[model samples]
Target: MITRTQLVGAWSLESYTETDVQSGEVSYPMGRHPEGLILYTFDGYMSAQLGSGRRDRFKGQDPYGASSEEYTAAGRSYIAYSGPFYFDESNGRLEHEMFVSFFPNWQGQRQVRIAAIDDDRLHLGPDRPMPFNGRLKTASLIWKRALPNS
Candidate 1:
C-alpha cells in the first residue's frame, strides 16, 4: 500500500510529453530540455515551478503560438498550493483536494492524479482525459525523487 511517508520530500521533473488530439502530433511540452521542480511533503504541502519554454502560453493566447513574454511570465510565477493528499494503492492513484492555490482560479478544486511509482521515479498524469480548449487530451509527467540533502 502506498503511504504518505513514502511520498515525502522533493521531486524534480524529468520529462513532460503530450499529444495534440486535434493535430495528431506529439509534443514534448518542456521540450527536449524541460525544466521544472515539484515538491510534495507528507504534511500536505505542495509547490511546483515550471520554467520558460516555447510552448508556455498565457490565459487567452493560442497555445500553438505561445510567445516568449508569456513563457517568461510563466517561468517567473511561483505556484504554491496546500492541501491533503490521499493515495489509493489498489488503484495506483493519488488525489489532492486543494484548499488554497497560488493560482486563485484553482482554489477549491479537487485535482486527481494517477501515478506510477518505480524505485525513485514517480510518473504522474491527469486521472481523466483533459479537455484542452475544446478537445480531449492527455499529459504525461515524469518526476524523480530528490535526495534528502539535495
Candidate 2:
C-alpha cells in the first residue's frame, strides 16, 4: 500500500499512451504531446483534467456564443471529472467514483485503477479498456509530482 504522503497531491501529466489488446501496438490518444493534471486530496476526493496538445481556439471569445464546430472540437479533445475516491489498502487498487464528468456517461461511474509510484513518477491505468474513437485500448498514463508554484 502506498502511503498517503506519496499519493495525495497534485500530479502533472507526462504521457498518456494506449496499447491495443490484439495488436500489442502503442498509441497516444491525446496527440503526441498531451497536457493535464490529476489531483488526489487527503479527504478522499480526486479530480482529473486531460487535454490534447493541439486544441483549436474558437473565433468568438464568448463561450456560449461559440459555433457548433468549435464546441465539438473542444469537447473532442478534453476530458474532465471529479469525485470521491477510495484506495484499498489491502489490494492497492484505487477506485474513483465520478460525481461529475464532462462526459455525461461517466457521471456516477466508478472506475478501478491500477496505481503505482516509483521515484518521482506515478503510473496509473489499465482501468479497463478505454475507448478512443471507435477502438478500445488499454491506457497507461504517467504523471510526475507537480512542484510547488510550478
Best by lDDT: 2
State candidate 2's TM-score: 0.94
For 8-111, candidate 2 gives per-residue lDDT tens digits of: 99999999988887788898878889999999999999999999989999998898999999999999889899999998877887898999999999999999
How much is 108 displaced in model 2, in angstroms? 0.2
- How many clashing residue pairs, candidate 2? 0
Tell me how far candidate 1 lies from the true structure as C-alpha RMSD in angstroms.
6.5
Off by over 4 Å in 2: none
lDDT of candidate 1 over 100-135, digit per residue (tens): 776677778778887777888888888776764366
Q: What local lDDT does model 2 show for residue 138?
A: 91
Using Cα atoms with residue i matched to residue i, what is each candidate's TM-score against the true structure?
A: 0.69, 0.94
TM-score of 1: 0.69
Compute the lDDT for candidate 2: 0.90
Poorly placed runs, candidate 1 (over 4 Å): 53-82
Model 1 lDDT, residue 72, Cα: 60
